[model samples]
Target: MSRPQHFGWFLARGFGPHGWGHPYLDWNYRWTEPALYQESVRTLEQAGFDLLIIEDAPSLGSPATIDLRVRQAFGGPKHDPLLLAPYLFAATQHLGIVPTVNPAAYLPYTAARQFATLQHLSGHRLGLNVVTDTGSARHFGTAPPPDHDGAYDRAEEWLAGIKALWNSWPEGALIADPARGRYADGTLLGHVQHRGDYYGFDGPLNALPFTDGEPVIVSPGGSGRGLGFAGANSGVQLALAPLDRESISAYRAKIHAAAVEAGRAPDDIKILFAIQPVIVSSAEEADRVVAASRDPDDAAIAYIAEKQSSDLETDLTALDLDAPLDLSVFGGHVSQGSIARLVGKHDVTTTPLSTLLAAHARLGRISDRTGFVGTAGEFADLIEELGDWGNDGVLIWGDLHPVTVHRILDELVPILRRRGILRSDYVTGGLRANLQAF
Candidate 1:
């Protein structure tokens, strides 16, 4: 027997160029305009997706890496996803739109007000993918950014202040009795005063109270502090780990433990792993795709190098391909996990840079159970297996382009529905309700 699981799409490219550097570029959908995203999200809703998480990094790297970031449009040149959320809401009624938000960017009062407005406008279908990145501190003119744990401390304060403002208005505060010629009972609203180590705010938020609930809180962090934050505050955890039964179970246990420590039920938070599967049409085609990528040419390697360079903010294209990569070249700001991902099983001391680059460019076929390259049926089998493992759901990651959305969902959706692994209809309330339906 198979149980239904939640599904979502991750807009990995943020609000930057969609379908750029791909065959779909010829579609000319105009990334700056809303029509492209609106159409894409409509398709997602029709497929019964629970939400769409839009990724954003609000900074164009430091001066040294600006060109690398934008030269390939891998990073930066992004418009605010928060601004893009309203248009997405107008296009679809049920699919939750989660835009990335940083605590460092906005004051507590402003962020609470703005988020409250969106949650009401979307009819409680809005979500916030809260991020703790402090790299954009310079843009906000705040004091210097804090260290790892300190950043989480600031985010904790920020979230607490926002919640206090949201709850300032008591149950009887809104007394909209038209016959009595009364709009609201101002006396019932409480004055909330919050003065913390990182933020200070006094408010009974001007925004109206929610009819359903506050906006869904989504978070993506893998560190101990990050996991603790999710356990304490998040409704959805954007998880990342190897997609195996043992690994998945262990990861989930950790989250459940953290939730217990925080005095929250584990069911309060849904752990949705991020997966990008290459959905092909047939097994033969999958085999051919895998075969083609076994040995990448110079062009393929160069493309991989450019993407890695943008992510690390350290130029890799100029490095000698034949020489061993020096780990010390990476700055303290660079993520050690990212560096580990860039240099997989092979060692940096002995392996040449080209070998490492070529390894990343390689792909494996799903028929052999090696990688994610497979037909719709094969992908469905993977999803069903995840459900059996007591997984909450999986988020299919890709650009928010019409072609990309259709390419993956067209065949995969039907197979999933047939197996009773995907929902065919959504519940009435909103994102929170739909997620809790099963």
Candidate 2:
């Protein structure tokens, strides 16, 4: 297999709690402007993004404090990611849709059938982001004695079963005959019976593997169990978010090393980092726009603090805006502790009050992290730096959807094409074929 250079876009718009913090009903109104999804997919297709990673959660929950607003916001029926991919694939020829699915809640047969059907319909424009049940166990109401590691043990069996099911049908199984009115040959359809630690499944996956081998496999698991899962199964792409150069390099090396251990080529996996690029026509204009996207009020900041670590109501309201933010108040670092590590790595010590206050305005910036907040050329320069700093590419994010998408497509993409870092037109084929892998 020829290893193609990898790059992809992430779509967490409807289900992820990562953006804007809008209520569920109001989410589509604010985060996604009218027709933005179609436009964004087109932009990605035109820009030669390898695939669009679509994230989905069966349910949303915080491990620590239950943020009632957050829960209420996500409590409604969500857009089924697997169900949505066909429509998205129909709309675009080259862009692949990788939807995240939890292995715990659904059966392997059902999951396999749905994905196979999707691959058949889209001509194989699909990828899988396998999220083990660890991160959302409590949220799913399946109280776990099995830690993430245990869940992953179960996940291995699930993956194996899924693969067996996908391969159940032999090649040339479909022979539509008019004389006898036969649609398929029974000899081609084989049974896959599996009885494992976590699950017992039997039969041929009730669908055809597209003319291609299968949809691409992608995952974002960095934990030991997640790593093993990715190494054993993930082939085309891997997703991650690292705040600094050292972490980015380390993560890339880790992925390459994992591939080697898995008996796969080291460069087989592509790395795409998650970033919300706030680009505008000018540097000052970009900064102004980014600042505007931040909440000037305390409620949102407090909510972020609660989600990230411990409660910080007392210390958050008492610091100078210009001073370095201190991490002393939460006793240590809280949830998303990497934010703390990034701060300490850059020597950005400040009162919790100051950090919270600044978070409401500066967004995820500490003293040193960089975001694309400038003219098209400047954004391109930063993107190149990220690539040189050892990332395969950057996955652009928006503070607000359509606005961000419009600016990126109009501004940044053209500059990238001129610089030869991004393609001017999509390669012809399904998602995997466009990415140039078997």
Candidate 3:
């Protein structure tokens, strides 16, 4: 099937009823209110957003730390991604629902069954974003956590196991024979066994996943392990850096190379990037909003310190912000390439601590690279450029409330439609079908 142009919006948890803001934390809130999220999803569906990425926090890690406290203060409650799925499905006809899953926390079989059921219910509109976390292992409630490589090792096997279970049962295996009282064909559930370095599993999953191939398996970015995993799994969409053409090209090349190494077609892997759009009626208005929402230099520094939780307050504050990050000083503790890029942008050696903080504050939506911040026409241009440069689509977030992102659906979608870059209406099926992965 031909690849369909894909675009998405992310809805996260908020710290308050109005926004994701929290007084204790330096960073502003990310998730809007429930009513806003619902409205946003519907608007995005109409605007032709191929998917809506509803972030799920299973374990309270670094980011979730902020969310957890906020929830407590707000008198406790809200729907998680899983519960939100059915609502979104009912609200929109074609938009995809991608809920992130961390393999270490969730069982492979259980996750497979959950996603499979969602796909079945949404008519295949579900997609899985597999995340093997690195930085915040302490939050997993394990005293001694596995290393990054170790986590990926287990994750790789877990993913393989899930895929095996998905394919274990063939179509027509479930006769549901009411007269005979036999629900399944006993011989059809193929057993799966694996004794790899990090994981060991046996037999078919209790419940079959696809009965067909399954939902789109989406991978975020290119780590060595992530690339290898995607290469082994065909039809996986790879999410990469948004807006930067150079990064997009490089990522696509890496994905294709990984696919070739794994004996799969290069084009089988789809590449997407994060786009934090700041849309407005005029270019000036967009710029103003972007600037207003950003953190001050000192605030940025404090936020970084809080994020790292290293507590080397004096030493961190002593460094100059204009110099490149001292790799020797920050070798092991930092998270991934994503965070690394955020630090790399500002030279922290000579600049003042406050200066450094503000510079690195608004890390670009995708990998800290500067991206779209203009009128509707300018955004359309950026999207087209991304496509031409080899990225499949963008996973978007906005600076302000629903208005900034909502405008994309209202304004930019129409422009994309006019340019033949976006679909005019629902394509007759679910997320997987719309993505042309069917």
- Best candidate, lDDT: 1
lDDT by residue (1-438, candidate 2, tens digit) is: 112235576765543332345333343543222244565677677767778777665643343433432443432224566766666777788777888777876789988888788887877788988776454456546654366567678777887888889888777777667897888887878778888877788898777656765778887777666766777777654555555678777877777877788898765666677766655566567667667756556655545444333222123334454566655644221223344432533456444444544453454322234444566676666667676675566666442254455666676666676666775465545666666542
| Model 2 clashing residue pairs (backbone) | 324-350, 325-350, 325-351, 326-350, 326-351
- List candidate 3 stretches off by more than 4 Å: 1-4, 12-18, 22-35, 62-80, 135-143, 176-183, 193-202, 208-212, 234-244, 286-333, 346-352, 361-371, 399-401
Worst 10 residues of 1 by lDDT: 329-338
lDDT of 1 at 244: 80
TM-score of 3: 0.78
Q: What C-alpha lDDT values do all the predictions have?
A: 0.91, 0.62, 0.61
TM-score of each: 0.97, 0.77, 0.78
Q: What is the lDDT of residue 73 in candidate 2?
A: 42
Candidate 1 TM-score, true structure as reference = 0.97
Question: Can you tell me which runs of candidate 1 are displaced by over 4 Å?
Answer: none
What would you estimate as the lDDT of candidate 2?
0.62
What is the C-alpha lDDT profile of model 3 across 1-438, one tens digit per residue?
Answer: 122467777543322233434342333333433455566677787787788765544433344233433333221233356666776677767787776677766666677677777788887787777767654456556656667677767777788887787777767777888999988996977877767765566767666445334777776646777777777663545464534667677777878888899888786665666766656688667666567647655565666644332221123434545464454554343446744454555554554445544564553221122645677788777777666665677777542245545555667787788886776677665665676642
Better of 1 and 3 by TM-score: 1
